[model samples]
Target: MPATRRPIRQLPDELISQIAAGEVVERPASVVRELVDNALDAGATQVTVRLQSGGVRLISVEDDGQGILREELPIAFRRHATSKIGNLHDLESVATMGFRGEALAAINSIADCAILSRANGFAEAFLLDGRTGELRPVARSVGTTVEVKELFYSTPARRKFLKTDATELAHCIEAVRRHALARPDVSFAIWHEGKLVEQWRRCTDLDPVIALDQRLGDVLGQEFLTQSMRVQTIASDNNLRPRIWGRVGIPDAARTRADQQFAYVNGRFVRDKVLAHAARSAYEDVLHGHRQPVYALYLAMDPARVDVNVHPTKIEVRFRDSREVHQGVRHAVEDALAKPRSAGLEVAAQLDSAPLNNGFSVEVRQPQSVPMYSAQPGIGLVSKPEYRFGMQPDMPGHKVSDVGAIWQRETAPVADPIPQEEWPLGRAVAQLQGIYILAENTQGLVVVDMHAAHERIVYERLKNQLNSITGAGAHPRTIVSQPLLIPVTFAATPDEVATAEVHSETLVTLGLVISPFSPRTLAVRAVPNSLVQGDAVSLARSVLAELGQHDASTVIERAQNELLSTMACHGAVRANRRLTLEEMNGLLRQMEETERSDQCNHGRPTWRQISIKELDALFLRGR
Candidate 1:
């Protein structure tokens, strides 16, 4: 069937605005985000958001910022009219959050909107109504107040898609929370049904880092400050490159979901894939399985290098060079988490203080004469040791046995005591069941999981050895490939086959050789030397999926880490192997020097500090 051609014409003003509204406004939260963007762009130092019925019935955003001129108040509601940018050059390097000018027009189209404002230098104030296009004199301070009533009233279909009032209110609060996190210099408050829901006060600290930390503590909670490490990385003499600064939660603080991950570019929040992928990759060596890391990373770079106008909502950005961003974020997070938390004064100070340790002294105790186990090659658990080594035999019936001497502390002169500050993990005092190493520090008891701690130390050492073998270069983590005795084939999707063929060189670096055996089948004839026993088909699938989404180095490093982790778990010192005082202390020294020694490769905590206050409470001594 043939249809007659119609002439193309410009759409009506109301229809055009409504069409733009569909993209700018998803729900009440969308309106809240856009309005807050405008308030912050106006140089607002304090912003108060009042909502009714989850902002569907009423939304009033009052900001103490430079208000609009009375003459320009009416034009502010017109589509494509904005004071943010002048032309294409301004659009190219947009520094403001709301420049598209589509938010006001789009929001006004579906809701009854009003703006009451008094310009900075003007004494008079005026109120402009969007529906009637009426302006009248009003009394107000030197600021702006924008009220949106009956959202989606004109478009009832959009209203039906919204969730319950409670869910919508939660989303609206989250939108404001994002803004508050980025700006510690500004105070924010949210009110629902005339009751205050949330508030974040402005920080007055002179140091930006301290102010940001205080803000994080207030918003994310004090536990975040205690469990996270500060991250600050600047590019070397490159002004255009990104300068990242924020905090990343320790491996032990990893959550089940990714809700706490927040990334901002030039003070504007964004959900960039490159930033998310880079942050996740940095935690691959420490966090295990489906655990998601928590971080609040703020990236500051030249505004010209990023295109924020790509999305209508301005929540997503397109970086001119995404590789630079990925590398910067990944390295920043990795460096911040490289050092163990136990070695830092920040963590030590966070421990509860008590007077219970006032009379505590370092004691060097002798080991009990218990049957000790010998190292069994390739064994990961306790082995039988029925006989003692280097035992002098008794001649016939003449026995010279003094078993008590072996368990007695030597009566030698004590050496000078070493300062506790020098040994953060402190001196090893005892070993509990050959499984835990208990030490004493200034803060109090330090309990270490011997097997888990040794596993992490061994894993780091293995990684360092691999890095040395590969050397520092573009392909620094190149894996050694091992040919398989028999090829493993699997039915592969076309996308997977395409990814395998296209990234053949990259796959080779990861020690994988996947090739097409048939139109619908792929064969993996080789794998990484360390992972030769692993399932080749599954390895190939994982590598292909990683290559499809991330760069070659990400996949290479991840695959190498998995192999090293398994090897480390197998090679670490086994449980139930009693250690001398010297051996235990040496292990503690190694742990203090090792990277990420606080947690094992499986994201389990390797060490814990039971503070003096905690001990006092446990024994009821504080009372």
Candidate 2:
């Protein structure tokens, strides 16, 4: 007869696992940690981690640690079954990083976990069932290999929350790197999907900064790493002993994300925004809006002054001397960015893939296009933004017009190219898709998205209106306000309803009239002529998206931004569209006159650059 099974009287198994999984599994990174912890506990001197497609489908961690004893194999998944610590008081002053004993329980609860571990004296391997926490005898390698398949299997909601494969993989890679760096004495080999990714031999000397070179070298390429800026500062006081030291590649040593700006406290990886704020504070004059300087920073402080158990991920940290820490970061960033490697430091730029008006790509590099103003001597963050693209819309997330090249014929619609002496940025190379403009800047090439660029242009116009001392300036643009034959109505959230009301008049100011039709409904009676010609629906949708994220900005600011973004989208160049040199120059000149021209409406930098030295190295000239 089969043994009587105890009924799960209370909760459903799925619900139970989901709750347990929260602590055990978050993303692919979480799985990597639990697996590595198991390996380390097994006394593994060498660990190998493998991931594929961001760990969506696979995550394998192998280690040569003291493998699990045959009988204790099943106990690994039982909650609180940790070898790190035993009993209650040990939890308070936990010596090991992970001793909750929940890592395996939590992981197995969410994912299809398979574990095979064998002790040194064991004659055969152990097959452990993660689901039931059951152990049995089997034959396998002496070391341990933990495989996690179908993560978040019991929690469907969490599966949707996972980021793209690339993003998730990046996070996993970062986590693995942290572990590898932390345990330098442990030989680490990382492979993914049948291919060897990284083979790092064991290090007799483990310094946190060692991985800094390896990490940056992978992201920025070793060529740039060869010539990095090193800056250091020392300030010792009873109240504060702040020391700053790091290497920052010239402005060109940049990445798509600010991943390189690592912050560490006491040899532990931490994410401190205040430190980031300080880092940004250091790059105040050097970097433009869309760019961030790169560095690997290590901060030291008394253990009592800092706290690490603040977040589940442990990325964020609290400092005892917040001010001193901030000051230290600022010193390091400024000093490193200011030094001599400035010669080879070129900015990472987006390829000008948009079609050009000249019938061929305008291959030219411009000089530091982050404008050198006659009105103001040099660049400063607090100071007004300098014109990089000639002219820019006043705000963020708007389209820029591509007026790269214009025709001199009588049939031409706009003016001719303004001379470069007057405003060199005003010159155009080509206009693409009716929106993006390929223009030449002094330091490097500038590619302007007409819609994003124009959004900035119009945003500035509205801002000037707000700041203008001229006439009450409420004068309507006097152009016709196109009416939709059928008014468009939308269901908005409570905040969006308030957002519509606050910006109702502002919308009217921009030639769009929005009114509350119901508690959750907003009626769009009229729209800007530009929007009406295209898709007014998309323009109206912007209000809902803008309000959902944050409401700190006033309705006027939000509405106005939405309006400008819409206008830029409608008026700026489109893909495969064409324009003349005159149009391009006009666009560039406008960007020059405007402020905050580096990035488009969405905070993406409109133009980027790779220095001549970088180009030469690409061709092996500087090698």
Best by lDDT: 1
lDDT per residue as tens, model 2, 465-549: 4444544655543223456666777777787778667655555655667678899888777765433433444566674456445
**Which ranges in model 2 have alpha carbons more than 4 Å from their true place?**
1-24, 37-45, 52-54, 66-75, 80-96, 118-127, 137-143, 160-171, 178-187, 197-215, 218-220, 231-246, 342-623
The digit string of per-residue lDDT tens for model 1 on 248-304 reads: 998877899999999999999999999999999998778878999999999998999
Model 1 misplaced regions, further than 4 Å: 1-22, 351-418, 469-559
The lDDT for every candidate, in the order shown, is 0.76, 0.57
**Candidate 1 global Cα RMSD:** 12.9
Can you give the TM-score per candidate against the true fold? 0.74, 0.47
Q: How many clashes in each candidate?
A: 0, 63
